[model samples]
Target: MLRQLGSGAQYLATDINQHAAETTQATLEAHGVHADVIVTDIMSGLDKRLAGMVDVAVVNPPYVPTHVEEVGCRGIAASWAVGLNGRQVIDRILPAVREMLSERGWLYMVALEDNDPSDICHLMSEMGNLREMFQIDAADYMMSICGDDSLKELSSPGKSGSIFYLSQDERFVIKTLRKTELKILLKLLPKYYNHVRAYDNTLITNFFWRPQDYSERRKKGSLCCDEKYVLH
Candidate 1:
């Protein structure tokens, strides 16, 4: 990314990670490159007006949830980053990207397996952009910054340890997830988090009954069962 920026491309950079944004600014400034760095939460809603006008917007958005307060990130994590996870991030950003992009302008985004590169391309295609605009494809997630999260801690199996059998030992690290990435992972998340686990590790017994996103419901319909956080 730094190399691409240094090649004399007029690029705009943004991050939900404030520290990362600061680092980006410092790095760009050191190379004598001036990039527009905006420290705002996209989840709070994006500035479609400004975003839709840029020629090319480069982004490597967050792949994981961050709970701490970061440097340049003034607001909460972007909708895609934390709230609805990866799918929402792309859904929220793509529209504005379409608006900001010049008629023939291109958006260079690092596609992830979690979010499905094909889905990204499909969405872009649906937006009236030239089908293929030089996309560098990637498979498997780049675990460049895989830090431990309270995902396990934040999940629950309804009726204490009696119902939910969590295989994730709090002592565990992030295991290599599937190619489907966060999309598949989301399917494993216990609906209501912070509940106790079942005594048996055979299956996660707890379930959180909560509201579903309008879109998810529209596609999968109401889940006969909430996303099962089983002991996989």
Candidate 2:
């Protein structure tokens, strides 16, 4: 990360949004990160600008279904939030990503339960000298947002929030928390500022978890689900 690896030298941060890029640049400068930041739209011929030479990359792809604008939310750099039912986004850049690796680089991507089979496999297959070292179902990060007041209404009785339906964009829309989701959300979400328990899923399953199961996680690492603040 810029904080640890930056070491007062050079680094690069890219975001499609000019505003976000500039804002990140300012924040980096404030923190003394003398790095290059690219604000170009990565969606349009992005692989060309960044063909290869990457040693490592940490990315958190968005979770939302598509390009519809939320009332106040800004979108991620690329339309990287491939719909749960399709593999377009991954299809666009995955091959290029595989080719871009230094033969030692590994793409540490997250696999959401809703992710399509092809995407998940492609996300983990032996690529550029990288084999899956480990895998653990991470705490259900999507359901963690339920604790926020703004999201509480999605849990109200009879609300369609928790219901699973297909989005117009063909992604599975799991609105509310389920038992497994609650189990993880309650466990990992307290670190965020102002988080509190909201609705309990009430659904049950004969499930068990181990500490070592979660030890494999890299919270600060990239290539995980990037759906921060994107879920309704």
Candidate 3:
């Protein structure tokens, strides 16, 4: 399905069972699609060559809960013999996919309700911090947000005197913080950062930037702030 959707993009498929790899290749051939199919255990031995280069990754890992001994078994059983909570294969694939992705990469994964998709998302979020792993410059992202001409103001129903602006891509929300709110956040910043770093399933909103005194540098169509701006 991904092959048909992204026909112009390169594809690489891997499986632990040689038969499964062969079947995948045959299916691609039948559909007149080209992809490199390899017999390997979840991208093993391909890291050095492909790390941090993949633009998109699709995963449908083995997710059936079964006895520990059933995992890695030969033939058809290897397809869905994930042990215990069905996270054995899924957990391994998460970090591997994170390593394989480019800075702007996206991942599409299949998960059962029993597999706990929320926890999986949280785990991937911790593993795929672009600023830490990819060394993306903070200033570059700030420039993109500040220079965006399509930012739209959202009406606030609350009586906190706060103004809200949504980014052009809708990936970020810029909120003008009051002096008291800024002080509280500044005081909590250290503890908050540490808490989020330690907890994989933390539900806190990710605050990207807290720029101070942006009134002088505001552009014509850019966001304006009297004191502080918080981007999340």
Best by lDDT: 3
lDDT of 2 by residue, 49-124 (tens): 4434567765544434543333124465344444433343343345445544554666655445555545355333
TM values, all candidates: 0.41, 0.40, 0.55
Give me candidate 1's TM-score against the actual structure. 0.41
Better of 2 and 3 by lDDT: 3
Best by TM-score: 3
| lDDT of each residue in 1-232, candidate 1, tens digit only | 5556565566567765688789889998997777777665442223323433466677666545334333224345442343323455555466446544665567787655766777666655543321121121111111211122222433332432212222233422222222244345344433212122223233543321111122332256532222322121
lDDT of each prediction vs. the true structure? Answer: 0.42, 0.39, 0.69
- Candidate 1: where is the Cα deviation over 4 Å? 1-10, 43-52, 64-85, 129-232
Candidate 3 C-alpha error for residue 83, in Å: 1.5
- What is the clash tally of candidate 2? 7
How many angstroms is residue 179 displaced in model 2 relative to the true structure, after the best TM-score fit?
Answer: 37
TM-score, ranked from best to worst = 3, 1, 2
Residue 112 lDDT in model 2? 52
- Model 2 CA lDDT for position 106: 64
